[model samples]
Target: MSSLLPRLHALWTKETLALLRDRHGLAALFVMPVIFILVMTMALHDAFMPGASIDVAYAVVDLDNSPQSQALVRRLDKSGSFRRIAVGQDLDAARQGIRENQYALVLGLPAKFGERLLAPAGADGQPTEPLTLLVDPTLNPALQLAFRNQTAAALGTIRADELTRRAGKLFGLPVSPAAERDWPDEIVSIAVQNQRSIRPPSSVQQNVPAWLVFAMFFVVIPIASIFIIERQEGTLQRLRAIGLPFGHILAGKLLPFFVVNQLQAVLMVLVGMFIVPMLGGEALHMPAGRSLIHWWLVAASVSLAAVAFALLVASLTRTSQQAVVVGGVGNILMGAVGGIMVPKFMMPAAMQRLAEWSPMAWGLDGFHTVMLRQGGFDAILPDLLKLLTFAALSLTAAVWLNRSSQP
Candidate 1:
C-alpha cells in the first residue's frame, strides 16, 4: 500500500507540475472563463439589472388641440418613462414612426374628444365613448401592458378633472378644479408578497452556474487536446510501458484538472456573490441552513460529465487537430441548443423542446433549480441521474475504444 501510495503521489505531483508549468493551459482553464463571463455579463447587464428602464417613444396625434388632450400628453411625458415624439398631424406620420421602430405606441386624440367629454352622458348616465390608445402590436407584451395601464390611469385622471371643472362651472361654486376632481384616494398601490420569505436569487446567481457549466464544457476540447497531443508524441505509450496502470494514468491526468476546475467554480461563485452587487445585481441567496455538500455534489457531477466527454472525444479522434475541430464545433452547437446563448423562454416552442437533448440545457436547469429556486437535493435528482448515466456511458465507450485501438 505504501509503495502504491508513493506511485500515486509521484504521478499526481508530476501532473500538477506539468499543469502549472504550462501557462497557456492554465490561462485556458482559468483566465479564459473569467473573460467570457465578463463579456457576457457586460452585454447582458441592462437586461438583468433592476429598474433598467426602456426609452419608449410615444407619437401623439392631437386633432382636438384641447386642454384635456394636451394635459394627457404632458402627464405621459412628465412620467419620464415615456418620451413624447413630435405630434403627428396624420395617421400616416404615426405609422411611419412605428414602421421605423422609433415609436412603440401612438395616441390619436380625435377632434370630438373634448367635445364629447363636455357633452352630457347618455340617458343611463354612462360614458358615450371610451378614450382610444393605439399601441404597436409588435412591441414587447410586457411593455405593451405597462403602457396600456399607464395610459388608462392618466386618461381616467384627466376625465375626472374635466368633469369636476364642468361641475363647478354649473353651480358657480368657488372650488379648485383639481380639488373638486374625484380622483381615487389611492391611485395605485402595489403590494408584493414574497411567500417564500427568501429573496429569490438574481440573474447573476442563475447565470453564474449556467455559464460555469458552459465554461467547463468548452474547456473539454483543450483538455482532451492535451491527451491527444501526448498520444501523438508517444508519451502515453511510454508512460504505460513504465508500468502505470491505465486507471492510475487516467486519475493522474484528471485529478489536477478537476482541482483547477473546482477552484474556478469557487472563484466564479465568490465573484458573482460579491462583485455582481456593484453592477446592480442582488446578493446571491445561499439557501438557509445547508452545508456546502450540495454545491460539491453539483460540481462533482458536472466535472465528471465534462471529463468523461473529453476522454470520449480523445478516444474517438486519432489526431489532435480532429479532436480540436470536433470538440470546438460540438461545444458551439451544444451551447446554442442548450440556452446558454439565449434564455430558454425566448426560444420558439419547438426549439425549447429540442433544448432538452443538450447536456448543457440539463446542467443549466439543474443549476437554476438549486441556485435560483433554492431547491434541495431532491430537485436535482433527475439532473444527477442524467449526468451519471451520460458519464458512465461516455467512460465505457472511451475505455472500449482506447483498448480496441491498442494491439
Candidate 2:
C-alpha cells in the first residue's frame, strides 16, 4: 500500500507538472468558455428581454379628421410607445409598414368614427359597430397585449366621456360633461402606472448568467479528455506499473480541472453579478442569505456531475480526438435538451419531459430555483440528489471500465 501511495504521488506530481506546463491546454480549458459565455449571452439577450427599445414605425390613417379622432392619435403619439412615421390618408402605406414589421400596431380611424360615436344608439340601445383596432398578430404576444390593453383603455375613456356628455345634455345639467369628467386623464394615468409596474429587466440580465453557467460547466468533458490521451499514450500503464493506485491517479488528474471549473463558476457568478450590469445588463438575481446555501449546493452538484461526465467520456473513448469529438458533441446535445439553447418554457412538453435525463437540465433547474425562485436548500434538494446520483453512477462506470481496459 505504501509503495502504491508513492507511485500514485509521483504520477500525480507528473500530471500536475504537465498540465501547468501546457499553457495552450489551460487556455482552452478556461479562456474559450469565457468568450463563448459573452457571445452566446449577447446573442440570446433579445429573446428573453425584448424590452430594449424596438423602433416601431407606425402610420395613422384618420378617415375622420375630427377633433376627437385627432386627439386619439395625439394620445398614442404622446405615449412614446411608437414613432408615427406618416399621418397620411393612405391605408396602403400602413399595410406596407405592417408587412415590413416596421409597425406592430396600426390605428385606422374609420371615416365615420366621429359621426358614429356622436350618433344616437339604435332601437336596441347599442352602437351599430364597435371601434376596430388593427394590430399585427405576428408581433410579440406581450407587446400585442400591451398595445391592446392600452388602446382599449384609451378608447373606453373616450367613449365614457362621450356618454357622460350625452347624459348631461339629456338631464339638463349645467356641468360641461366632457369638462366635468376626467376619464381620459384617469385612464392614461392608470395605463402609465401599469407599464411602470411590470417593467422587465434588460436582455443581459436574462441571458448572460444562464449562458455563463452553461459555457463554464461544459469544459469538464474536454479537460477530462486529457486523461484519455494520457491513457492512450500508455502513461497510465507506466504509472500503474510503478505501483500507483487507480483512485489516486484519477483524483490527481481531475484536481486541476475541478479547481478550474470551480473558478470558472465563480467568474461567471461574479460577472453576472457585477460586470453584466456595467454592460447595460440587469443585475443577476442571486438569492440573499439563506438561499445562498441552495446556490452553493447547485454549483457543487454541477461540478461533480461535470467531473463524472469527464471521467465517463475518458473511459468510453480510446483516443484523445475521439474523446474530444464525442464529448463536445455530447455537451452541445445535452445543452440543447437541457434548456441551455432554448428556455424550458418554450420547449415542447415531450422535450421538457425528456430533459430530465440531462445533467444540464438539473443544473439549470437548480440555478433557476436559486435565481428565479429565490429558493433555499430544501427547494433544490431533489436536483442536488439527482446530480449526485448521476455523478456516482458515471464515476462507477468509469472506474469499472478503466479497470477492464487494463492489461
TM-score of each: 0.74, 0.76
lDDT of 2 by residue, 103-193 (tens): 7667778776766765656745756544454677766776667766766666666667677777878899776633523444532212122
Give RMSD (Å) of candidate 2 vs. truth.
5.4
lDDT of 1 by residue, 157-248 (tens): 77777877877789897766444243453433232322353333346665677678876765566567677877889988997888777778
lDDT of each: 0.72, 0.69
Give the runs in model 1 whose Cα sits over 4 Å from its true position. 46-52, 56-63, 67-111, 115-201, 279-283
lDDT of 1 at 373: 63
Off by over 4 Å in 2: 1-29, 40-55, 74-86, 92-106, 117-208, 285-290
* Residue pairs whose backbone atoms clash in candidate 1: none
